[model samples]
Target: MDKKHIKALRKIVGEDNVYDDKAHMIAYSYDATRTRYEPDAVVFPRHEEDVSAILRYCNDNHIVITPRGAGSGFTGGALPANGGIVLGFEKHMNKILEIDMDNMVAVVQPGVINMDLQKAAEAVGLFYPPDPAGQDYTPLGGNVAENAGGMRASKYGITKDYVMALRAVLPNGDLIRAGKKTIKDVAGYNIAGILVASEGTLAVITEMTLKLISKPKL
Candidate 1:
């Protein structure tokens, strides 16, 4: 990216939120794969609007963007293969927006930690069943991106099974919402299913509504 582009990005997310220093780039260069390729810049967006602005600018400039979560995936999904911008969500967007006990659901930001959601649900006598091996540290967004499965998958299911809806910013910066909160709705194409496991190629997930179930008796 040119200096002008970087300036524009800095304006969108603030100077402190955007980093181009070698150390910062190196830190975000790799995922659990351990293979590294430094991105030109790394951006920390605090909200969906911040992400939208960044994506819009990147799109107009034809800059490649890799949306990243907790960097815990065995696959190199979070790695910046093409070397443009690394959109890191861990620091600012990691909030569990709502734990809807009545609906048995959770509305959360993409950066939310997987185990944190599990524990929160368990506190209410509920469970979010998808538990990847790295759930302790992995972000829920990464799990959704990878359609992660765990030991209980045979009995329960993977991330896709629990995801009810998603809010994502497309490569062109257009924001879209897919799926619905209701348990059963064959209203249209299953766009959310297509996005799950896309590995951040198609869009950047900003928020999600996840299904929950009663905690099984031990």
Candidate 2:
């Protein structure tokens, strides 16, 4: 990206929001993979709209975008395979929107911590289920994109098992939502399911709508 594009991105967020320093860029270039790949810069968006705007800008400019979180991925999930932009979602998408006790569900943003949700659900006499190894810091966005699986996957199930809907930006710069808050629906082609395990390739997730359930009393 040029100075003008970077300036535009900074305008979308703020100069402090964008990181292009050699050191910061170097640090973000490699993930847990130990493999080296550097993107021109990294942007930490503080809101859903910011994420969508960043993706739209990158996509429009033909710049690559890799949606990342926590950086705890074991398989280079955060590594920019081909340099472009690493859109870090940890700053934004971090709110737990609602807790519907009547329906036994909770709405959360993608950047919400997995363990935080699990604890909150338990506090409300409910359970969030999808417990990955990195429960402490793994962002729900990465979990959804990775369609993360875990020990409970064989029984309770994986992240996608509990995801009911999401708000993501496709490569074409459109902000879209898939799935629903309803208990059941067979509406369209299940774009929701497809986006579940896409690993940020198909698009970038700005927010997510997950299905929650009440904790069974022992």
Candidate 3:
């Protein structure tokens, strides 16, 4: 990466959040697959705006931006193969924004852990059932990106089944909201569906609204 680009990234997210050192790059290089591809830099986006600005700058400069979660996927989806910057969300964007019992829904940032949501839902007599093998360690954003399925998938379905809506940033830095929190949304193209399992090719998901269900009797 050029010095100007690095400086610009620091300006957008802050000096501390941008790491261009070899150690940081190496640390963020591999996923569960164990394959390594060191990125030019590893960036921690504190919010949606940070992500937008970073992406806008990167896009304009023709730089690669790899959106990463917990690095728990076997698919190596989180690997910074092309080497630009790893846009990591686990830093500050990991939060369960809301849990609406009335509507049986959840609002969450991309960095939320899968099991965290499951436990939170269970606490309220609800269930968020997609339990990938790495649920205990994987982030919800990675699950959604991979459309991951678990042992319970035969009965409960996979990650895409629970997704209600998605807030994502396009390659061109445009922010878009797709799908609806309501149970039924037939108003537009199934953009959310396309994004799910796209594996970071289409856009970077910043937040997600997921549908919940009554806790299954044990």
Candidate 4:
């Protein structure tokens, strides 16, 4: 991107929020992969709108965009194959909006930590299944990106199954919604399923509507 673009982004997210330092870029270069390469820049968007705008800018400039979440991926999913923009969700958008006990669901941002959610749900006698080994460090968005499976998967299924809906910032910078909360609604194509495993290839998930299960009352 040009100075003009960077300047605009800095205005939107502030200069402190944007990092072009070599050291910072290097740290976000690789994930759980053997391959490694520094990103041209790293942008931290605090809100869904900011994420959409940044994605739009990158797509317009033909700059590759890598969506990063805790950098805990195992298959090099977060590794930047090409030098481009690396978007990290660790800093902002980490709130868990609500745990809907009546419907058995949780509304959370992509950056929410797994254990935190588990703790939150347990407090309400509910549970968010799909307990991956990376539960300590992995974020929900990254888990969804990999369809992350764990020991409990045999009993509870994987990330994809619990993902009822998501708000995504697509490659073209257009904001889109995939899936829905409704139990049985054969709407448009299963675009959400396609986006989940794209691993940053198709779109970046900003928010998620996950299905929760309350503890069986005895």
Candidate 5:
């Protein structure tokens, strides 16, 4: 990685948000698997536009980018296979954007924790049923990436079933929105479906709209 490229990335997110020091690089290198592959640079983006800029820069420069969440993934999706850039979402993108009771839906950033969303929905008498074993520590984005499921999977289904829509930035720096909030949307190809379990190879997920269910009176 060129120093100029590193400086360009620092400009996108800020110096404080970019990491390249040996300590930071080593820290960002591993996931739950404990396998380490150091990235040339690690960036923590706060917004979709920031991600767009970074993706565009990397794309133009032919640099590999690994999108990472809370680092709880067992599949090593967060690992930077090639020494390029790792885009970490845990710092600034972890927010539940909306909890729409009427629609039984929640719009969230990729960094939102799975357990946090569950608690928020339960507080409002709603349920987000895709609970992985590491729900308490796993980010929703990683769940979606792995299409993870847990004890309730036989009854409730996996991550793909509940995801209604997604906002992702493609490798070419094109920002695209797929799927819709409506309960029954068959108007076009299931682009969002293709992305659900892609494991960060296709695009960088920014926001997700999850379909919730009414809390069962159990």
Candidate 6:
């Protein structure tokens, strides 16, 4: 990226969040695959609006954007293979917004770790069932991107089955919401279904409302 482009990015996310030096670039270059495809810059978005602005600028400049979570995926989904911007979410956007026991749903940012939610739910006598092996380290967003499933999946189901709603930014920077929090509120096209396992191809997921079930007695 040119100096002008870098300056613009820094303005959107602040200098501290935009990295282009060799060290930072190298660190974000590879995931579990260990295959390196260095990005020109790595940008961390602190909120959903930051993501919208960044994607808007990148779209206007024709710069590629690769959305990433914890970088624990076995597949190279988080790699900036085309080399532009690696939009990292783990830095600041890793928040669990709300856990509504009334609805048995949890609202979280894309950077929330899988096990974190599982523990949080279990503490409340509820269960977030999709448990990928990397649940200890993997982000829930990455799990949804991959449609990941683990041992409990045989009886409980996978990530897609638990996702109730999503707020995402499209390639052109449009912020959109798909699905609803209530299971009975299904009245639109399955946009959330399409985004599941899309692996950041369709849009960049920012926040999600995930369904939870009552904890089973062992």
Angstrom error at residue 118, model 4: 1.1
For candidate 5, the TM-score is 0.97
Query: 10-120, model 4: which lDDT tens digit per residue?
Result: 877878878888799889988776568788788889999998888777777788888888777778888877877788888888889888888888999988988888889
Which pairs of residues clash in candidate 4, taking residues 3 or more apart in a chain or in different chains? none
Assess candidate 1 and give its lDDT: 0.92
Clashing pairs in 5: none
- Per-residue lDDT tens digits for candidate 5, residues 1-218, read 78998899988889899888899898889988899999999899989999999999899999999998777777888899899999988899999999999989999999999999999999999999988989998899889888989888999999999999999999988899999999999898999999998999999999999999999999
Worst 10 residues of 2 by lDDT: 84-93
Please report the TM-score between candidate 3 and the true structure. 0.97
Please give, for residues 78-152, the per-residue lDDT of candidate 1 as tens digits. 898899999988889999999999999999998899999999999999999998998998899999999999999
Q: After superposition, how far is residue 24 of candidate 2 from its true place, in Å?
A: 1.7
Residues 1-218 of candidate 6 have per-residue lDDT tens digits of 89899999999999999999999899989998899999999999989999999999999999999988777777899899999999988889899999999999999998999999999999999999999988998998898888999999999999999999999999889999999999986686999999999999999999999999999998
For candidate 3, write residues 44-74 as lDDT tens digits: 9999998888888899999998988878778
The worst-scoring run of ten residues by lDDT in candidate 1 lies at 1-10
lDDT for 155 in candidate 1 is 96
lDDT, candidate 2, 149-202, per-residue tens: 777778688887888878888787788888888878788888889998788888
Score residue 15 of candidate 4 by CA lDDT: 85
TM-scores of all candidate predictions against the true structure: 0.97, 0.93, 0.97, 0.94, 0.97, 0.98
